[model samples]
Target: MISQKAKYALRAMFALAEATDDTPLRIADIAEAKAIPRKFLEQILLELKRQGLIVSRRGKMGGYQLLRSADDITFGEVLRVVDGPLAPLPCLSKTAYHRCEDCQDEASCHIRRVFANVAEATRDVLDRTSIAEAIASGQTEAMLDAQ
Candidate 1:
């Protein structure tokens, strides 16, 4: 399941992506437009900026903008920033892979196998999904999972 924080990050980023020519968006406006809390949105956007997913502009009309093109920003990339890993188990996670201490043999671990498939499925969806696509469809994993 996609966390609320990840959804907000995507929504906030999508709202900025929908902007013309990197024009900045005030956090308040973005939050209101996306129905995110202003303070929380600020924190989320800052983290995204720190992660190089966005660029912040200062002063009036200053808020945030995508550092990269919407088409170039994949859902997996965004998900990674907000959520630690796509996989439920550390062993199943590609980026954060580490053998579970309790599991001496992953070859026979049913839980690891199931979660590995889930990770692959999640990654396939998120990796192929870009911000531009999300904007066009107006959909996110949250929306998909809600159904």
Candidate 2:
């Protein structure tokens, strides 16, 4: 399961993506809009900024904005940033793979084989679904339906 931090991050990103103007959104505004706690939102925003997912400014006109276009940012990327690898098992992780301590052979392990497929399918959908696609009217539902 993805962490609560990841869910908040996505909500914050969606709020930013929905911004039609160039104005940055304040942390309080994002928190209220997304129902995320203010302090937690600050931490999440800083992490996102460090990862180059969003940018922040200072002063009265200061807030946060997407560093990249919404269409260019995928759900998988954000999830990875906030929650680490998507793999159900460490051995199934492509970016952070670690062999199971008890598994004798990864090549023949039925558990590994099953989870590999789960991880692949999860990655496929998340990587293909962009923030823009998600916030668009009816697009997310249609995409899932087709999947």
Candidate 3:
């Protein structure tokens, strides 16, 4: 299962992606817009900001915005930022790797091969999906309209 962290990140990004050409909006606005819990959204946004995905403002009319254009930010990239490795098996992971403790053989492990393929397919799909596409596809929840 992808972490709640990743889900919140995606939801928040969608909110930001759909924003007008005006200024950024507060975390509260994002949470309310996406129907995410306010505190949870704050923590997720902070991590995303730290990852350089979203930029945050401080003080009076403070808020957050995407650091890069929506098209430039892929779903896979956001997933990586929030979920770390996409692979179920450590050996199949791109960012974090560790051999399976029970598997002694690497050359003829069909299980690993199967998982690796799954990981590859997963990566391909998410990599192709961008925040811009998410918005352009009009794939938002009813919460978006509510906000």
Candidate 4:
């Protein structure tokens, strides 16, 4: 499960993506728009800024904006940044792989095999799903639902 922090980050970023202009969005505004707690949104925004996923301004118009286009940012990247590796098990991890201590033969490990598939599928979806694509998909789904 994605942490609330990651969820909030996505919501905030998605809001930025949807902005009609390149103007930065105030944290309070984003929090209010996304129904995120103001303090928690502050922390999440800071971490996102530190990761270079977003940028901040310091003046009267100071706020936050996406550092890259929404189409250039994938859910996989955000998830990894906010939640760490997508692997369900250490052995299945691509960024932080480790042998299972109790495993006799990695090749024959059924549990690892199952979770490897899970991890791969998860990564495939997340890595391919950009914020722009996600927004478009949601809009399409909503239209379909309405029809």
Best by lDDT: 2
Worst 10 residues of 2 by lDDT: 138-147
Off by over 4 Å in 2: 138-147
TM-score result, candidate 3? 0.91
lDDT of 4 by residue, 32-93 (tens): 88788999888888888898999999889989999999999998898788889899999998
lDDT of 3 by residue, 1-147 (tens): 666667778989998988897588898888888888998888888888999999987888779989999999998999898878889798888888888899989779999988888999999988998889877887645423443
Candidate 3 off by > 4 Å: 142-147
- Name the TM-score of candidate 1: 0.91
Best by TM-score: 2
How accurate locally is residue 23 in candidate 4, as Cα lDDT from 0 to 100?
88
Q: In candidate 1, what are the lDDT values of residues 13-123, reduced to their tens digit?
A: 778988876568888889888889988898899889999999988898688888888999998998899977888888887788899999979999998888778878888
lDDT of each: 0.85, 0.89, 0.85, 0.85
Question: C-alpha displacement of 53 in model 3, angstroms?
Answer: 0.3
- Per model, how many backbone clashes are there? 0, 0, 0, 0
Question: Please, what are the lDDT tens digits per residue for candidate 2 over residues 82-146?
Answer: 99999999999889999889999999999999989999999999999899989885464344334
- The TM-score of candidate 4 is 0.91
Name every residue pair that clashes in candidate 3.
none
TM-score against native, each model: 0.91, 0.92, 0.91, 0.91
Query: Which candidate do you rate higher for lDDT, 2 or 4?
Result: 2
